[model samples]
Target: MNDPTRAPQRVQVAIIGAGPGGSVAATTLAEAGHDVLLIEAGPHLPVDSAPHFRRDEMMQKYCNGGITPSFALSTSMAYLEGCCVGGGSEINRGLYQRTPDTVVETWRRDFHVDGITCETMVPHFEACEAVARVSPLRAPAPPSSLRLQEGANRLGWRCAEVPRLVTYDDKPSGKKQSMSATFLPRFLAAGGGLMPDTRVHRLRRIGGRWSISGTRRGRTLDIEADTIFVAGGAIRTPALLKRSGIRRHVGGSLRFHPMVKVVAQFPEEINLPGMPDPVHSVKEFEPRFSMGCSISAPPLLALTMAEHPDHMTEVDRHWRHMALYYVQSTGGIGSVHNVPGFRDPLVRVQFSRSDMAELAEGLKRLCECLFAAGAVTIYPGISGGVVLRTTGGVRGLPDTLRGNRATLSALHLFATCPMGERGDRCAVDSFGKVHGVDDLYLADASLLPSPTVVNPQGSVMAIAHRNALHFLERAAHGAAKPRSSDGRTLIARSNL
Candidate 1:
C-alpha cells in the first residue's frame, strides 16, 4: 500500500526532528543554498516563549514525560523527557561540556573512527561554538557549587567551571528558549522549512527513494525525499529504525549516563528554589565519572524515593532544606529489542559489578566533599543508611543501597545508533550515514558511538555540525565517493 501523502515532494535534504542536530544540519544545508525540509514530531514554539510546564502539559507534549516506564532491575521507574520542539534541549538544563580527550582517544583506538582527535574535532567544535555561542557557565559560584569546587581545590584535584550554552542575564526573571530558539531560528532564517505536529511512523524504501510515512495534524502524510536524517534521540531513533526494518546492527547497543542525585539540605536555600540551573560540573573524575546537582527534583523523581514508607518522615525533613547533587556513571553497552508478543522492546541495563564498586567510591567521595564544605548535616542517600547528621558516623552503605533497582536515577541515554567505520558492528559510519543504507542518516545523541562520561550536549552538537558539513557539501558539490583499495565502485553519490 502506498502512503497517501507520497505525492513525491523531493528535497535536497529531509531532516527528521528539528532539535539541535537537525537544526544545525538544516541551517548548514540551507545556508549552502540547498532546499531542505525539516520534519518534527512536535509543535514549534512561538517566537517568544515562557515556561508553562505543568505535569499534564509536559506529558501531552513530551514523550512519556509523566508516566514513562524504564526498566530498573526488578521494576520500572517513571522517566521524564521532553519530545516537543527542541527535544531534550528545550527541557534539559542546557549544560554544555566538550567530550573529554580520553573519550576521544577511546573512540579513535577502540572504535576505529579515523580523525576523531580533539584537534580534528576542533574545527567542528569551533563552528558549533560560534553558532551555539558556547561559553563557560558564568556567575559567582553559589556556595553549594563553591563547596564542591573548594573541596576539589583543597584536595589538589582537577576541576573547572563547566561550560553551558545559555545566555545569562542578571535581570532575567523566567525561562528562556535555548537550542530551539538559537539554532532553529538560524535554520529557518537560512531558508529552512519546518513541519510540526508531524510524526513519521515508519520508513519504506521505494525504488531509490525512502518514503517517510506518518501523520501530521490529524492527516496522513508521506514524504519522499532524497535523504532522511533520524535524530529522534537514543530511544525513539532506534525504535523507529527497527520498526521500519532498517536494522543493520541497530535497535540495540544502548549506552547511557546513569546518574544518582541526592538532596543535601543546607541551613539556607543553596540553589534558588525553582530557578533555572546555572552550573553543571565535571571535575577530576571526568572521563570516568561526573558530579553536578539538579536545581530541583522532578516531582515523579521526588515521589518515587520519598514516598517509601521507611523514610517518609526523614525524606520530608530533608526536602525543605535541600541542594541538588548528582553522581553520573558511564554505562557499558546495553540494549532494548522488540520482544515476542510485546508492543515495545524489552529494555535492560547491566552495569558491571566492577562499575558498581566505582560508583560506590564516587558516592563516598561526594559525601565527603560536601561535608568538607561546612555542611553541618549530611544525608547519605543510600536507601537504608540513616540520614547522617555527622558525616563520619555513616561508614558504609546500608544494605538497601546495594539494590539493583531504586539506585541513583540516570538518564542521558545514548549510543544505540552509534557511528563508526563501515561494517564496524554499529549502525552508522563516521559521518553518521547508516551502514548499507544509502542516503539514510542519523543525528542526535544516539550517534555518540561511546559513552561521553558527562552531560554531552557539546560533543553531540559538534559531531552533528561535523556530519552536517560533510553531508551538505556532498549534497551541493557531490561528496567524494570512496572506493575499495582495488578501485572498485564502493559507494556512489547521486542527485539530492
Candidate 2:
C-alpha cells in the first residue's frame, strides 16, 4: 500500500506495465546499472497461480475477466489482455515467432521505419529467445497437434510445429517461460524495483522530467522520472497517452488478427485430459490468415457450444474427443478512446466487406482441413451456426459471414501507437521515442507499425530489447539528464 500523503518518489527511469516488453526493457536497463522501477496495474503472482485455460485463471490473470470487447457498428469482437504482472505472457501458450521478413520490409516501406530488417533484428530476437528458453517440443507433439499436421499434409498445405517459450525437461508438459518466470526475475536480480497493483492514470510533462499520476490500492501515488517508458500493452498504452493529451496517431490505427473458432469432435479420444495446446499450425495462407489448434478445456468448450444448447451435453460426454481450432486473419481496424467518466477505454473495431469474405473463406478452409483430419462433427463458433458432419457441408457456408451472427475473438493486438519516421501517422520515432517528447518512450506492442500476422510476443520483446539499448546509448551520451521536482539539475549517474 502507498501512502497518499507521501512526497512524490523520483527515479532515473520509470516503466509502466510489467509485461513482456517492460520486463525485458527493465531487465536490460537495470543490468546496465540504471535505477529502473517497473510498475504493474495488477497483482504479482506465480506463473501457476491457476490452471491454464480455466475460468479461475481468467479471473486471476486476464483483464476484465477475459471479457474485454471492441464494439463495431455491425458486430462486436471479444479480445483478451492480461492484467497481471506478467501480462499475456503468463496466460498465453507462449508460442513464439519472429516478425516475418515480409512484414518488416512492409513496415520500412509503408511506415518509414528505419534500421529495421530481418537480419538486423536477429540478434535482438535471439537474445530474448535465449532468456525465455524458446524451443520446440523435444518429444513428439500431442495427438491433437498431429491431427492438424496430418490434415495439412493430406491436402499438401504447408504446416509445421511452432516453437514455444517453454523449458522442456523430458516431460510432455513443460513450464511456460513467462515474464514472471524469466525476465521479471532477472530484472529483480539486477536490482530493479517493482511496484505491482499500481495503475497509472495519466502522464504529464514536468519540465524536463515526466510526472506519473496513479493510484495504488485506491490511494493516490505520484512519481517523477527523468525518463519514462510506457509498456502498458496495446490498448492501455494508447489510452493512457490519449488521456494525457497526446492523441496524435495514438490508438487511431489499432490492428489485430480477427479469429473465429470451431469445436471439432472426433470418433476417437483425440483430446486428452491434460493435453497442451496444439503446437502445429497450418501456414499455407501466411500473412492473410493462419490455422492452429487452441485450448479445448471443458470450460472453453462450453462457451464455444453455448449457441448450440443441444450440443452442450456433448461437451460433458465427449470432451475427450472434442478439440478447438481457430482461423485468424490479419483483417479489420480499430481505435481506442478514453471515455470521460469510465475508467476503461472504449474500443471500436470495424471489419470491411472484404474482411468478412476472407474470414468466411478461412472458416470453410478450416472445416475442410478438420474434416480431412477425421473429425466426425464440427461446430462453428458463430451464433445460429449449423454443425457440419461431412466434407460437402463446407460448401454450405456463407460466402460472406453475417456480421450480426459471427462470434469473433482476437488474441493478438498491436499498432495502436506505431513507431516510424512518418510524422503524419506514427506516434513514436524509429527507436520508440515519442514524437516531440524527449525521454518518453514506448516499449510494447503499441510500437509495432502493423500486424505481424503471428503470435507477437516475440516481436514485442525483441523490439523492446532493441529500443532499450538505444535509450541506454543515448543516456551514455548525456541525452538524459536527471532533474528534481524543484527544477534543479541533479547529479547524473555514469553507470550506463
Candidate 3:
C-alpha cells in the first residue's frame, strides 16, 4: 500500500473514490499509459478481508458500519455503501446485469443522452465482464436460491439465475470478482498510483489546474491534476460537487430502489450455514418491482427479525428452516445535500402514496411466492406486521405501506448527477463532462440518469469504461481545450 502522506503532489489524471466506477476509470487510463492516481477515503483491505455479510465484514468494509440511513416524511430507510478500496463491490453479492434496452431508450428520450443505445453499450459491458470474469455458477444453485425458482415456476412467473461476477473453480461459492481483486490490481500492475485513507474535502480550480484538497491521517493533503474524474458513488459525488460550488442540477433528482424484506420459515431445512447469497431472482414483475433471496447469516437474520421480538427465538431454534427474501421497487425520489460542518452528506427520500401501495402489493406477492415454495410461516418486515402461514393469509397485508409501520431499505442508488445535454435538468453532458466544468468528469452511479431497477454495479462499470474511452479519444483528437472564466476549467490541458 502506498502511503498517502508521501504520495505525489500531482498527476495527469486523478480518479476520486475507489469504487466500481473509479476502479474501472483508473485502470483504463493507466493501461493506456496515463499518469492516473486512484484515491480512496477508506483503507485498502484484501478482497477476503472478512467473511461476506458478517458483522466483521460490515465493520471493515461498509460506510458507517452498514448503518447509513436516509430520512423521509414519516420514516427513514437504511442503506449501505462500501468505503474501502473496492467500494460496494467488496460488499455486494456481485449479481451482474446489463442496463436494459428500455432503460437506455428512456435515458435517450428523457435525458437527451447521446450515443447511448443497447448496441453502443454492448462492447463496454463485454469488456468489463471479460476483465471481471462474469460467469454462472458451475455447481447447482443453492437450496435457498432454488426455492425462489421453484416458487416462481409454480406461479408461472419468469425467474432466472443471475450470473455473478465470480471465478468459479468447482465450488458452490466461488471467488468474488470484486474491484480489489480485479481492476485495482490490474491498475496497480499498469503503474497507477493508489492513495487510500485520504478523504477529499473539496475541489478547487487553481491556475487552470485542478487542486484536490483533503486530509490524510490528521494532516492536510493536496494534489494537482491535469484532469480529474469524480467517481464517488451517487451520494458523495453530488455532495462533493455541491461542496465545490458546482450545484446546477446536481443533487436535485436522486432515485433509488426501495426494498422490504421478509423472513420465511420453510418446512424443510433450506438455510445452509455457510452458503453464499441466492442467485435466482423473479423477473416477471420487473421494472416496477422484483423479488429475490438475501443472505440469511445469523446476525442479518436477527436484524431482520427485530420487529417480531416475540418470534426472535425462532431464528435460534429453526434457523436451518429459515431464509431471508425481499421485494424491491424503483419507487422513490430523493436528494443528497452536504450538511454544513459535517463530512457526511444528508439524504432525504420521499415515497408517493402509489409508491407505498406498490411496495405493499410487492410484499403480498413475495409472501405468496414463499408459501408456494413451501414456507410454513412468513414474517413481514413491519413494525406491527402479522405472521402469515398460508397464501390466503397474504390478503391481510395492507393496501398501502405506512411509512412508520414498514421497514424499508435500499441497496441501489443513482442519478444524483444525471448525464445528458439538457441544460435544464442535466448536471453533466451526454459524455459525462460536467456541464460548466472542464477537465472534470463524473464516472460513477451519479452519472446514471435514473434508477437501473436492478443491480447497478455492471452498469456503473460499463458506463465508466465508455466515458473513460471517450475522454481518451477526445484528448487524442485535441478536442479538450481551455475555457474562459465564465466556464472555468478545473484541470489544465495536457499533451497525452
Candidate 4:
C-alpha cells in the first residue's frame, strides 16, 4: 500500500475501485501521459498467490464470503461480487458476451442515449477482446458442457459456445485475463499509483478540485485530484455517491439476473474440475431467461445437495457422476441504500411475480433438457421437488416455487445508477458523466440502464472503454472545468 501520509499526493485523475472499469480507466489515462491514482477498498492480492482451493478463493476474492444477499419482502437470494484489487474481473468466470444488438438499439431509442449503438459499440468490444485475449476453449468441451449442448440440440433450441477472457496455450493452467493479469499490470508499468486496502470515507469537491478522505490500516488518509471516477460495482457505487450527498437517482432500480440451478446425476463422469466451462448457452428463451452449465466441483455439489438434506447421501455416493446446470432469468427492479455508519449497503430485490414465473418455466425446461441428455436423476434444489427422471415429471412443478424452497444465486448485477439522456431519475448522462457531479464519472455496470440478459463482463468492459475514450476526448479539448463549479455549471459550459 502506498503511504497515505506522504505529502498530500496529487494527481490528474483519482479513480475509486480497482475493478474492470477503474483498471481500464487508469490504464487509458496513464498511457495518455496523465498522472493517475487508483484506489481499491480491498487488499491487492498477488495473482501468483490466488489459491487453487475454492474455499480459499472465496475468502480471498469475494466481498463477504460470497454471501451478500438480496433482501426482499419474500426471501433473500445470495449475490456475490469481488472486493479485491481486480474487482469482479478477478473472481468471476471469464465468460464473455457482447451486448446483444437488440439491447443496444433499445437503449438508443427508448433511453435517449446517444453515441452508443449496435454499430458503434463493436469497435470497443473488439478492442477489449484483443486486450483480454478473449477466445474459445482450447480443447473439446467437457462432458458436462457437451451434455448441455446436446440437450439444447435435442430440444431444438439455439445453443452456442460462449467466448471467455482467457489466454489458452494448450496448457493446464490457462491464464484468465483478469484486470490483475492484464490491465492492472499495464497500468502499473505506465506509472499509475495504486493504493489497496484503503476505504474512501468522504468525497468533496472544493475550489475546482476533488478532495477524498478515507482510512487505511486504522490511519486517516486524504487525496486531492483534478478529477475523480467512481468505478465501484453497482451496490457500492451508488452508496458512495449517496454518502457524498449526491442523492438524485444515486441508488434506484437495481437489477440482477436471479438464477435457479439443478444438479444432474449421470451414469458417467461429468465432474471434471480441470475442464473449462462448455460455454454452451440455450437462447431459445433469451432476454427473459437463458440456460447454461454451472460448476460441478465437489464443494459446490455438496453445498447444493445440502439444500435438500435427503439428497446428500445420494449426491455423495455419485458425486463423480453428477454435474450442474443453471438458468439465469432477466432481473427486475431492486434498490441499494446506504446505511449510516455501515460499510455494507442495504439491498432490496423486487423480483416480481412474473419474474418468478419466468424462472419456474426456465427450471422446467432445464430439467427436461437434463433428462434428454441421459440424466439418471435430477435435483432442482427445491424442498418439495421430487427427484425427476423423465420429462413427464417436470409438468407437475409447483405453480409458484416459494423463494425459500428455491436455491437462487446471482452474479450478473446491473443498474442502481443507470444512464440515460434526460430522465428525471437518471444518475448519469449517456456518456457516463454523473448527472449532477462535475469532475466525477462512473465506469462500471451501474451505468447499464437495464438487465443485459447475458454474461455482462464483455459488455461491461466495452462500455467502460468507450466512456473512458469519451472522457479522454473531452479532457483533450480543454482542462476540466474548475473544481469550484458544481455539476450543473460544468454541464452548462461544455458542449459534450
Question: Ten consecutive residues with minimal summed lDDT in candidate 1?
Answer: 487-496
Number of colliding residue pairs in each model: 2, 0, 0, 3
Range of the 10 consecutive residues with the lowest summed lDDT in candidate 4:
487-496
* TM-score of every model versus the real structure: 0.86, 0.95, 0.95, 0.94
Model 4, residue 449: C-alpha shift (Å)? 0.8
- Model 3 alpha-carbon drift over 4 Å, by segment: 1-8, 170-172, 481-496
lDDT of the candidates, in the order given: 0.66, 0.88, 0.87, 0.80
Candidate 4 residue lDDT tens string, 1-496: 3345555656677889988888888888778777777888887876545654378888887888777877877746778889888898887778889999888887777677888788899888887777788878877888998998898899898888987888877555578889988888788878777888888877898887888998877788778877888999888999888888888887887888988888899889888666776678888999878999877777787777766677788766888799888988875678898887788899987666777788888899899888888898888876674778778889988755556667778888888888888567578988789886788898898888877888998878888888888888887777453232222111000000
The CA-based lDDT of model 2 is what?
0.88
RMSD values for the candidates in order, in angstroms, are: 6.2, 3.3, 4.1, 5.1
Q: Order the numbered candidates by lDDT, best leading.
A: 2, 3, 4, 1
* Residue 27 lDDT (model 1): 75
lDDT of 3 by residue, 297-358 (tens): 77788888998999999999998888999999998789998888888999998888899999
lDDT of 1 at 446: 82
TM-score of decoy 3? 0.95
Candidate 1, residue 318: the lDDT equals 62
